[model samples]
Target: MGIKSFQGKRDTSQTNKAEEQILVSDYMTTKLITFKAEDSLDDVIALLIKHHISGGPVVNDKNELIGIISETDCIKHISESKYYNMPSDINNTVGNNMVTDVDTIDKNMNIFDAAFKFLASRRRRFPVVDEHGVLLGQLSQKDVLKAALKVKGNTW
Candidate 1:
């Protein structure tokens, strides 16, 4: 799962030999603003707004990665509340609206795999975890781009 273990995906246009040489840990952001599953949607929303991020990773009692909640998820909650004439801030917990079956990447994974994964999905970021499933950091599509730009032989 380290940088050297990357087996470049042959079919991905965004992947190259250089990207395969980088590890996800090298690019993942460790300073993260996270949320808990038991927190209210309003709480998550306020924090997200304060941070100016679209979403954040959800952790459990042990501070392990559990799910994810995003602006899109919040909008869905708002829409549901509106349709029911309820307030989003009143009684909804992040667990009720978060996507539990989250797609995560191991921190040991390479940039090529990470880039291809992002290319295949609509996710803007992925929660990076260790082999034990503990939260470590976050990998964003932008981070992958930086890896690409930093590759050897590439012009700035």
Candidate 2:
């Protein structure tokens, strides 16, 4: 009977964590400073510096989430341009060089799942979007960690 009670308590603890209902929308940053695919690399660099972010999401004309641009990507582009004797202004558009294979999150996803995604990938942040892929907000690993810390634990 003691073993049965202990098992039940363990199951209940795991259930609480799995059933936590904190969604991405609850904590995502809504005031996102987004960028356009047509934005030049110099412009993106300036914006990133101004916003104090390592990267920003690339949106379409309709403000739909498409891709992401990171500082690493920019640095690589600049280095390659210099090494290959290519004009930085030429072929240096975000749309041409930005990472199109972006991993995104839906606003309705739970915080636990978001945490898992962060663990499985090295991405610093994710673009949160609507069903139609519209830019809704941004979710960082720190945001996920913050949400995780809010879940009711066995201790408190």
Candidate 3:
């Protein structure tokens, strides 16, 4: 019998379920925080602070995933930039150093792959991309954690 069929045999479908049926798209956050490559660091920071988000997807004008920007990126820049040499328009430029190369996944990628990527990267979330690598949404650690808890039959 198939896994879903086996799941149907369970007494309580609400709990004791396996993760095989789950995909990143099933739980990924569709409401994404995104920025263009040309957007300023100051602007990105304000968005992050306002939304209380740790990171955002960096996209091209075509809405393709170019990279990601995180609180770490901002902090690293702030700590490393020398005050004496700092440009007056530092807030207007989103420096190359502030963006992280995107490690993206497709909407159909299995949950295991998403979980593995999260475990491997320094990022707690991944930008989901389309077949052509366009930004679609994001899968966060929170989503993965929730799935894990559900599999383990635990309540939040």
Highest lDDT against the true fold, candidate: 1
Q: What Cα-based lDDT does every candidate model obtain?
A: 0.85, 0.84, 0.74
| Candidate order (TM-score) | 2, 1, 3
lDDT of 1 by residue, 20-126 (tens): 55889999999999888779888888999999999999998777999999998988988889778975563488888998898999887878788889989977999
Off by over 4 Å in 2: 1-20, 83-85
State which candidate has the highest TM-score: 2
TM-scores, all candidates, are 0.79, 0.81, 0.74
The alpha-carbon lDDT assigned to residue 21 of candidate 3 equals: 65
**Separate clash counts for every candidate:** 1, 0, 0
Candidate 3 lDDT over 1-156, as tens digits, reads 655554446456445454346788888899887887677777888999999998888877888887788888877666666445676354545546446556777788877678888788866887888888888898888988876775544322
Q: How many angstroms is residue 115 displaced in model 1 relative to the true structure, after the best TM-score fit? A: 0.8
Query: Model 2's lDDT to the true fold?
Result: 0.84
